[model samples]
Target: MSPSAVLHRQLHQAPTLALSGEGSYITLEDGRRILDATGGAAVSCLGHSNAEVRQAMIDQINQLSYCHTAYFSTKPFEELASLLIESTGEKMSKVYIVSSGSEAMEAAMKLSRQFYLEKANPEPQRTKFIARKQSYHGITIGSLSMGGHKFRRELFEPILLPNVSHVSPCNPYRNRKDGESNEEYIARLADELDAEFQRLGPETVCAFVAEPVVGAAMGCVPSVPGYFKAMKAICEKYGALFILDEVMSGMGRCGTLHAWEQEDVVPDMQTIGKGLGGGYAPIAGLLIGDKVIKTLEESTGSFRHGHTYQGHPVSCAAALAVQRVIQEENLVENVRAMGVLFEEELRKRLSDHPHVGDIRGKGLFWGIELVRDKTTKEPFDPNLQLAFKIQDKGLEAKYSISLYCGQGTADGIAGDHILLAPPYNTTREEIVRIVEVLQAVLEDVFGELKV
Candidate 1:
């Protein structure tokens, strides 16, 4: 079948067809092999192919594919829930499974609202959610409303839900002034959030939602030191839930199972996805904290939100296997070891490039910001679409690197950056190869634009 046989995102061209995959490589229909760098938006933590995950899927398909959650609970669902909660200790006790990150985010928002309502703090006025600018929750209406990406939210602005406010993200590279210390910057952002809560009448706020490590929106930007701590303090003082959207950064992606773990603060609720099922299945989940669960249990007696595919048997089985692989193989340890190597290699190779501005990340997730002028930290013209150019060049170089395009790392609609989130179990050789490909691709593209 032709590529045009299926719907494509880039209306002008047909899509590439993949014939097979192995390890961290994908073979196109025409027999060209491309390294699966970025793991398809950082989802394939276990890489393209895993024998154990494959067997787990096959076994579950043979056993059962679907079951009504209301009538019966499957072993896979129950076991996956237990595994997730057990990893986080007693703070997290409930897990709500869903098919996609957006679905999980929707569930999390609803749960936060429901928890508040159940606590009788439902001052009806408390519906506003405070998210960080340059943040992305998901693509659904609810999650979409929570996001602050200018491009993603532009078209839907007319119909978007109201009462969602955005504050400056804790991005030191772009948001912090030249003379500011990390502490001062964090404090300033925290103060801004507190001011927003005050402006909204603190009591009228339901939650402050943010990606623990900014994901696709800002290209794997981690918070400045003490940012989350300050943010959590403000949330506590304002009586608002702290919701960490770890959908793209959690599940061992950042050298830790939970991104918030390194932040030294547990969120009231957390949304997780992508690496949750390691791209082995369509699965994502919300990790509910004890306080929120208790609020519902003691008041409403049940959550008001659920989906037909929530806790799906087959998806749960695949996720369970994925989790086991992450734990048993100590892949997260590898993420930490290799993440340092990846970042070092990136710095050594591209940090001095004329158009390369900053290289920053944690664990296996990293981002390279592209610019028009290094001294001015100026971004290329939006028309050039430098991120896409880098992506195309990488593809031509036989590396399937994904550049998460964002328009606001430098401002609200100008900066371009590329995120690299290779598999957790990637080797040193693969990391070197990825860096070589990226350097070549960037040199080729940036040279043409003369940035």
Candidate 2:
């Protein structure tokens, strides 16, 4: 490969180039086909190419592509926003479309603050946010401040906003006692959140932000039963808004249109992305619930934020088309049925494996945590880069599989897990291929390590 001007995620070398995609695989420039079990960070839901989404983008371009959202509202944006709101059965009264998950989260944070500011009697002191440790919301400055990932935040800690605090994530695998019931664990977590709110002055807290299913930071770790309901009760008691970051876990990736639907708790504000556009376009949005919408309506009747491409027409058209496909083909049902099989097969195959510590997730999102010792649940040293190594090795001709890998699963800087988030429309044969190839990749990696 020749040296390139494009700044890649890894500064040392350019990664493999993908020439094209179809179904659950991407064709590389080297004439190799890699099964896309990872969905490129859980973004490609309708797979890499879909005719409807492509046509929609082209149609929108033919009609109109760019119009400052501040000046005008486009049909695709309006229709997409309405579709999203109605998908929640109007539980969310409005949607503010943006270009990416980070922007959606940034909008949610500001909207959270604005929700309080637009109240009958503005409470200017309610400026703090409470998130969870071992969580990631996004990568922008504000979103980064709200996130609790230790490694991602370390370098920017000094300059990041100081108003966000964190509580223990509701991770039963690492935090729950051997015999603790779900109720006990939830009570303990709720108490911890309440304490944090009290420590910060409950009235001064704007919102409590969390992911319905924890994403990259912890690798698809869903909360224990009733965890979200209990946490939301605490936020409501203190008159604080509740925000759910479902950028990676929502949009039917977890077998529901919204991950929070399974949790039985509707957030005051919600951020969604990743699977929303299904890699058809860059699109994400903030869903505003009735409480916040009413408050803002009665006060200023406007959100105090704007982006250059807040409601990009082409992106909206692609997302709208992608969602229609998900709904039209009943793909969410497929995700549910296929996810059960995927989980059972994974557990059956890896439960007894020495290095496979935990298998957790829901719907189509699942993660396998690799450990140094299954008995002690000790993670391999971060320096080993075990998860990333497994990812790179999966690209070899023998495996030709791609896995979504993550580090810091146990704590802020330890543990490793690789996630599988294949397309919602994935079939059994593809899933079997993914699992068997993953097994082969693991065998190859451990064999190479001579462990």
Candidate 3:
């Protein structure tokens, strides 16, 4: 590979060139295969180079590549929308397609704002949004404004939106009292949210947005039982929207196609991506529940929003095909069954490790939080960047595996964790190999640190 002009994530260092991908492995320019355990930030749910997704894109391109969405609607997107809505059993009455998770979240924010205006009563006073601390929505301006990640927000704090506020995340490992029962913990969190809503003057709040299984900041942490229901109750009491951001956890990554499906409450709006097009195309969407849809249908009859590639035909076709393959092959079922085995293997192998603090998540979305003292649940010093170090170690050919890393797991700035979200179609053999590589990589990284 020659010196390049591409502006990569790290300006000073060039990343290894991935020459090809098959199944769960990516072959670099030097021909070393690295296991894609994190699925490239949990995007490649169907893994890389899936033939069906490729052919779908090709067919759509040959027929229709680009059409102004304002002027026309595309078949692939229409069908994809129907497919998604049907997956929700029509609880989500419509789907708004977008190019990425950030776009979906941006749309969600806008839609929530519009929904209030379009309602029968039209409460224009609803201007505030509340999200949990240690949560990540997206990186774009509107989405970033709504996110609660301190480090990601600090640099742009002055310019970020001031209407959004943060609350404690539903993380028992860190937040719950030592003697707190799950029921008591959930009750306390619910009261806290209710208090926040009251403090904001319930009528002034538009929505309460959160991840069903938190990503990035909290590293794959799922809410406790009845947490969503309790939170949604607060939203309902306050007549505000309940939004779930599933960009990293939905579309079968968490056993079911929708992570909210397991939470026993339907969100007013839900954002999904990463797995939607399975990395074959850049795509994500917002699923609008009947409440919002009916509001728009009766008052405005149209969402006051538009994007040039609102429903890119090729992207939709690619996503449609990927989703069909998932359905046809019963891969979501595979996720449930294999998820049990994966969890078992991880706990069996790593449970006794001294530094491993907590194993948390649902289905294939799991996080291993690292701590300096397991007994005190104290995170390692942020300067060590332990999670990032483990990620780098896995990328080395000797270990030969990929792992997603995150910091600020304990707070919005302190803990470290590694995320494991392998493709849903992963085989038992591949799962075993992934764990083995992970164990080796962790050992190597820790051994070098001499901790």
Q: In terms of lDDT, which candidate is stronger, 1 or 3?
A: 3
Model 1 clashing-pair count: 0
Q: Residues 83-178, candidate 3, lDDT per residue (tens digit)?
A: 999999888989999999999999998899999898888899999999988889999988999898988998999999899998889998888998
Candidate 1, residues 319-375: lDDT per residue as tens digits?
Answer: 999999999999999999999999889999998898888888899999888888899
Local accuracy of candidate 2 as per-residue lDDT tens digits, 338-413? 9999998898888888899999999999999899999889999999999889999999888899998989999989
**lDDT, model 1, position 22:** 82
Evaluated at residue 153, the lDDT of candidate 1 is 87
Candidate 2 Cα outliers beyond 4 Å, as residue runs: none
What lDDT score is found at residue 84 in candidate 3? 97
Compared to the true structure, candidate 1 yields what TM-score?
Answer: 0.97
TM-score of each: 0.97, 0.99, 0.98
Q: What's model 3's overall lDDT?
A: 0.91
Query: Candidate 1's error at 273, in angstroms?
Result: 0.4
